[model samples]
Target: MTVPPDDPAIRAQGLVRSFGPVQAVRGVSLEVRRGEIFGLVGPDGAGKTTIMRMLAGVLRPDAGEIDLGGIDVVAEPERARAELSYMPQRFGLYEDLTVGENIFFYGELFRVPHAQRRARSGQLLEAAGLAPFRRRLAGQLSGGMKQKLGLVCALIHTPRVLLLDEPTTGVDPVSRREFWAILYDLRDSGVTILLSTAYMDEAERCSRLALLHAGLVRTCDTPSGLKRAMAGALVAVVAGDPRAVHAALAGAPGVLGRLLMGDRVHVRVDDSDRRVPELRALLAGRGIADAAFTAIEPGIEDVFVALLGPEEAA
Candidate 1:
């Protein structure tokens, strides 16, 4: 089916799913625009995987509707799935097969013509920086290389929509950056992407993000918009002893919330001007006088922490 360029590439409405006793997705709804990267950001067990599965037409939602490229996914899963490629956390890559073999096999599975498969494989492998390793066995590749291989296989058919579930979970920093570069290229080439990630930094790279918590979407907006929606001013308390700083600020007035960010304590307050001095005095009285406090803009993680609170965020 030919989808209109102006319509959403993917859409879900009041999606609900369950696993016997656990309700994994609760009325989740979101839309992915064409040629953009839309991200589902949350901690583990936050229904990211479940929602991705549903969006891929691999798992049916108990209720709600899903449309992919203008096709009714729930009613015609096979047709819907043909328009999208889903790369799960553990993509099915045959360890014994060479990278080229895996891509060819997936192409056959997708029913691409022999000549088209060859051309597409060459292009995707080159784009993913795996052309040199085409003959290398999948099992012998590095973690990042394996991920890129999986992605190449998934893109073999050049589907309209791509769904990734934590594609860079255990990948090294450099590989993760490289993988994101490939995604940016795809988006530029007009492929719509919907990905789920636990990494807040990765979430910031998306064109828009949906912050999920406890099977609910707390908020959905651009990263900057979400940060601007944060209820309080964020103050970063930098001290040699982060635990001591946290203890000192415990129960302090005007403090909305507090979270530990590496060596610093990010404390949210209604008024930083009034509370910064009070917090400083509180720390000084505890014999800690050299602590530094700076007002900082909230990152994606900070916004998530504020929305879910420090406990649920942890």
Candidate 2:
């Protein structure tokens, strides 16, 4: 159950993809270790899907080398694809096919033997909690159920590496949690998973994360390491007018940064230990009272805002 030392599961160096005049991915290099979950996180049109497609051997990169499980993906796509499974944002599931039928179809396409396909389909159906609904048409399933069915199809042949593009989007909270549970089980069983996600919480679950912004890798590290690299301390400010507080504190002395999170304003300071008193007085001077403030640790979202800064350019 060991991946060869020479095989990285997925390795790309200087990867670049462009659409005519627009460059989607620029000089992106990534390596996913065996039996680990790696996350690529960013906003819409951030080139995450482009990279995933290239690794899956669906879309060719304009420049760079892609290797999958010791096979050159660009040179030998067929061989590379044989060892990988890709679940795109919109999975290809036959609406008229039953849950069991769809799984069997994918297994057959992957060239799984008849005996193995039967056993594998049963195990996958049970694992996805779709065994009881095996006879139901895929179109009749709920959004979450459909997503689970898609995952089961992708994993029917037990691929060495799994590439998922926003697999949990539009899923309910409970189902998202369950989906992650299943993913953890797969990782524990020696699958290398590289997934793209918009949810900050989901990104935090990965062993390591790469932040992609404007077609570049802004930073890549473990979640804890990224947070620790943040230079300022985070302070949450609860005010009657959070917007006003945000504006008032934008360039105020001692303020390094600020983020608007729902109803609270997260302010970053040059020094968390000393900024509280000054912040309070500054608000008081502006006739803003009853402001509740607390020093809190920075999360992934906070780090993103700090790095990206305010949306409007200076």
Candidate 3:
């Protein structure tokens, strides 16, 4: 199946899935444009993994329509998979196989011609800074290096779309930055990417994001757009004890939501102009003095917390 160049690289609508009585996804829909990075952002058990699996054709959806490029993923999984590469949270990287061996193995599995596989491997290894470590055993590589190798293996066949599930979960900050740099390069080269991540920073980096909560999509928009759609103003409260500050503001009038971030508590209120002073007085009445309040710009996580509500935020 060949879609027009302007068509979405990946599309799904009314996606519904369940594991016995527990439904993991409900009416989830998404359209990823060509050459852009789309993100699925949510907490654990938000059905990120299940959605990725269904989109990858690794798991059959109980009810849904999935189109990969021009191929119907549900009706023709094999053909659709030819244009898709999915790297789940736990990618299958053979521990004993050397870096180069694993790449060759996946290339063979994809049936890439010998000449093409060799050339592709060299380019990917060098681009990922693994050219010098091609002979190292997969088990001997560091966590970050192992992830890069997994990405290299996934890209060995040059699929048009890539699905990554929390690829940077445990990687160090510096390595995570490097990994994203490679992804940027891929996107620039016209490979559409759909990835799920728990990190707000990563979510901010995506071209657009779908915020999932309890088997449903709360919202979908660009990072800045989502922040702009935030209903109220966010006020950062810094006090001696963060938890105590949160408790003091619980159910306070005009307060929409509150989230504790490190030493500060971000309180969403109906109006920052009026609530800031009122909140200060209330805190002082509770014998909490020296609390400083500042209105701050809402972040992606703030929007998520507000949408998820206090119960789901927990």
Off by over 4 Å in 3: none
Please give, for residues 219-304, the per-residue lDDT of candidate 3 as tens digits.
99999999999999999999999899999999999999999999999999999999999999999999999899998998898998
lDDT of 1 by residue, 143-218 (tens): 9999999999989888989999999998999999999999999999999999999999999999999999878898
Instruction: Report RMSD for candidate 2.
Output: 2.0
**Best to worst by lDDT, what's the order?**
3, 1, 2
RMSD of each: 1.1, 2.0, 1.2
Instruction: Give model 1's TM-score versus the native structure.
Output: 0.97
User: Whose TM-score is greatest here?
Assistant: 1
The digit string of per-residue lDDT tens for model 2 on 1-314 reads: 35576567788999999999999998899988888899998887888999989999999989999977668899888987668999999857999999888987888899998898889778877888888999999999988899999989998898989999999999999888888988999999999999998888898999999988877778889999999998889999998889888888978888878988878999989887788988899899998887899989888888877788757211
Q: Model 3 reaches what TM-score against the true structure? A: 0.97
Local error of candidate 3 at 190, Å?
Answer: 0.5
Report, for all candidates in order, the number of backbone clashes: 0, 0, 0
lDDT of 1: 0.92
